[model samples]
Target: MNPGVHAGTRGTPLTPTGLSRPSVRSAGLLLGLALLAAATALSLSVGTRHIPLDQVWSALVAPSGTESDGIVRELRLPRTLIGIAVGAALGLGGAVMQTLTRNPLADPGLLGVNAGASAAVVTAIGVLGITSFTGYLWFALAGAALAATAVHALGGARSATPVRLALAGTAVNAALFGYVNGLQLGNLNTLDEMRHWSVGTLARRDPALLLTVAPLLVAGALLALALARPLGALALGEDQARALGTDLRRTRVLAVLALTLLCGGATAVCGPIGFVGLMIPHAARAFCGPDPRWLFPFCALYAPVLLLVSDVIGRIVVPPSEIEVGTVTAFLGGLLFVHLVRRRKVARL
Candidate 1:
C-alpha cells in the first residue's frame, strides 16, 4: 500500500484502524495550544510599558475603563490577531507548496510568490499610484499567478522533483527581487510604499484589515483541505498518483491557486513576511510524518502560534522601540534555517 494510504485495516488512506492513535494528535494539539497561550501572554505583558501577565489577561477578558486595559485591548490585540492570520496562512501555504512541488526546501521565499507579490504591489505603488493595501490584492494575486506560471514553464512537467523545484524557484526569486530592488531605487513612491511594508508589522491600522483578508485565507485553507488526499497520492510520485486515479494537472492547478490565495493576500496585507511558510511545515512534517492530511491541519494550528510568538518577541525584546516582525522572523528563521541546512537532512514533505 502507498504511504498516503495510512494504517487502515480496510486499506483506505489516512484513517487508522479506529481511535487507537489518539495520543499522537492529542500531544500535537496540546503543544500547539501551550505555544499559543504563552505567546499571547508574552504579547500582552512584555511591551514597552510592561503590564503584568494578570493585567494582560484582565485587559483581554475584562476590557473595562482602566488605562492598561485600553492599551492592551486597543493597541496590542489587533496586531496579535493579524499575526495569527498571517502566520497560519504562511505556515499552511508553505507546507502545501512543498508537498505539491515535492520540494522540502520550497517556500514562498524560495519560490516566486513573495517576489511576485512584492513586484505587483510595487507596480501598483509606482506606476498606478495606489497606496492602500486594500487596493493591492488584485496585483498581488496577479503576480503570484505569473510567477507560478513561470515556474511551470521553467521547471517543465517532469522537473518538479525536490531539488529541481527549489532551484527553479530560487532562480525566479532572485530575478524578481532584483526587479523589485530596481523599482525601489528608482521610484520614490515605490520606496515609500515598500519601506514600512518591507519591515513586516502586526500593528495594522484596523482589525477590520483582517476581515478584508480573511476570506482569501479561509478559501486557501478549505482548498488545501480538499487537496490533501490528492497531494498524498502525488507524493508517491506522478506515475504512481496517475495510476491511483489522481489527476496531476488538477492537483497542480489547485495547489497553485491555493498558494496564490494564501500568499498573495498575505503579502498584500503584511508585506513579505518570510519563512513562516518554509519552516513551520518542516517542523510539522518532522513530527507528523509524511501525510499532508496530518501536516495540513497541524500547520493550521501551529503556524499562527509561531507567528504570534515571534510577533510577541518583537514587541517586548526591544522595549519602547520594537523590532519589525520581518526582521525578527528573518533573524530567528535564518538561524533555524541555517541549522537545517547544516544538518543536510530533508524530512519528506
Candidate 2:
C-alpha cells in the first residue's frame, strides 16, 4: 500500500484522506531525499576555502592533481556520514519513544537517556581513566540502560502512569546531571577534560565511532519498527491494546532498549545531542501519519540531513572557528519545543 492515499492506524487502515496517499508519501520521501542530497553537496562544496562546486564534485568522485579530492573524500565525507547516522538515530529514537509512551513530548534526551549515558561516561572517566571512545561505548550503553530502568521502574506499574513516567524521567535527568556536576567539581582537571564531552558536542569524533555504534543503533531502530503494530494498539489505551493482542509490557521494554542503544552510543561518540529526538518526530508526523514504520525510517533520514546541514551552516557562518553542531540544533529545537507546547498542533502527538 502506498500510504499517500489512506491512513493506517495499527497495521489497519483508519480512513481515506482527501489527497492521494501514495503521491503525498512519495512527495514527502522525495523532498527528504532531495534535501539530503542538496545538504550533502553544500557540505562538500562550502568549506573554509572556496572550493568550486565542480571541483568539489570532481574531487569527491575521483581524485585530481591537487589534494582537493582527498580532502573532500577523506575528511569531510566521514564527518558528514557520521552526522547522518547520529541524526537518524536521534530522530528515529524520538519518533519511537513518542509513540511508545503515547506522549508528544517524549524524546531520548528529554527522558534522560542521554543524561544517563553522559553520567556513565563521566563515572568511567573519573574512576577508570577511560578516555577511548570505543572502550567507553558499553559504559554509555549501560548508563542509558540503568537510567531507562530507573524511569520505567518509577512509571511502569499499574499504580504508575505515563505522566509519572515523564516526571520520573525529569527527576532522573536532574539528579544525574547534578551528580555528574558534583563529580566534576573540586577537580579542575576532570572538569576540563569532561567539559567538551558533557556539553552535547560533535567536537572531535572518531571515524570508527560510527562503525562501532551503527550496528547497535540500527538494531534498536529495527526492533522499534517491529513494535509499530503493538504500539498503535496500545495507543488506543492499554485495555484496547490488550484486547487487540498487544503486549504493552514487552513493547515498552523493547522500545526503551532501542532508545538506550541509539542515544547511548550517539552520546558516547559525540556527547549528548538534544532536540533531534524531540523535534524530528513532529516533522515526521506531518507525512508519516503517526505510524511508527513510516515515521521511523523518515525520521532517520531527515534527522541526519537536518543535523549535518546545521553543522555545515555552523562551518560556513563563522570562518575558521566553527560553532558546535549541538549549539545550533539546541537553539532551533528549543524554539520548536516552545511552539509545540503552545500551538496545540504539536501537543496532540
Off by over 4 Å in 1: 1-22, 153-171, 338-349
Model 2 compared with the native: what TM-score? 0.88
lDDT of 2 at 324: 84
Query: What lDDT tens digits, residue by residue, belong to model 2 across residues 1-349?
Result: 6654455544444335644554567778999999998888877777676667898878866677688877677778778778877888888888877887788878887568887887888888887887777767788888888998888888854444567778889999999999889988956666777777766655467788888888987888788778777877877888898899877777777777788877777787788877889888887777767876677878888888878878887787889888888888988778866776677553564
lDDT of 1 at 169: 77
lDDT of 1 by residue, 218-255 (tens): 99989988999999999899899999999887787678
76: Cα error in model 2, Å: 0.7
Give the Cα error of residue 159 in candidate 2, in Å: 7.5
What would the TM-scores of all predictions be?
0.85, 0.88
The CA-based lDDT of model 2 is what?
Answer: 0.78
TM-score of 1: 0.85
Score residue 190 of candidate 1 by CA lDDT. Answer: 86
